[model samples]
Target: MDNFLEIETSVKRVFNSFRHEVDGILDRKLTGGEFRVLSLISSGVNRTTDLSKKLDVSASHITAITDSLVANNFITRHRSEVDRRIVVLELTEEAKEFVASIEQKKKEMIVRRFSVFTEEEREQFQELLKKLAEN
Candidate 1:
């Protein structure tokens, strides 16, 4: 394989491993689509149309995720006062707590992983990653 393709494949493998490891350790059952919707709601209250645009998904797909989240009690809908027909989606406190717990576990796991690298190596790796991300 070409060097660029090899790097791309390695990146994909790492991403998949990270997802599987974190999901297994946190015991969070969210599918990638569900997590994307939850992430959008966590950012702020948004109308379904806006969420569909932000997520780059079909309107019907966004509606399905919102409906599932609502049914699961992870999100709640509020009618806009000025525009009675418009509804906004907001994450519930319970969902926030669930997200927090999952985050905490992931942080712990990352911290444990950090122990494998020397302090200087870790710092340099982080700095280089931040620089790469900026580009």
Candidate 2:
């Protein structure tokens, strides 16, 4: 607790715990990376390059993830009408439904997990996390 390394490890453990919760909520239907890409696409990040930059991964990695999503019928890739060279990603109808369902489940899980914290504590914790993330 006194050392930065210990704090870092604790933070990592907390992240891992959340990831595990998400995995359970997803029922192993999607890997964490795939879920992330889908979430970003749903939020209107529709370009592979943008996704790569946002996720801080290589374009090739995005391509691979998109390929998997495509094969699973979770997304579609199309050429931009204004720029044929540019690829745009979009969620399929099935993906939209899936996203909604998963979001509900995640919300429930978050509520259950954070129930120990009062509203003010949760708000303060979120603000602290935002500050740390910004720095």
In model 2, the clashing pairs are none
Query: If scored against the real structure, what TM-score would every candidate get?
Result: 0.75, 0.93
Off by over 4 Å in 2: 1-6
Candidate 1: tens digits of C-alpha lDDT, residues 1-135 = 459988889889978887887778646567667766777778774789988898788999988988999999988999999999999888889888877777678789888868889999999989998998999
lDDT of 1: 0.82
In candidate 2, what are the lDDT values of residues 46-107, reduced to their tens digit? Answer: 99999999999999999999999999999999999999999999999999999989999999
- Native-to-model Cα distance after best TM-score fit, residue 18 in candidate 1, in Å: 0.8
With candidate 1 superimposed using the best TM-score fit, by how many Å does residue 115's alpha carbon deviate from the native? 4.4
Q: Give the clashing residue pairs of candidate 1, or none.
A: none
lDDT of all the models against the reference? 0.82, 0.95
Q: What is the number of backbone collisions in each predicted candidate, taken in the order shown?
A: 0, 0
Model 1 segments more than 4 A misplaced: 25-28, 114-135
At residue 128, candidate 2 shows an lDDT of 96
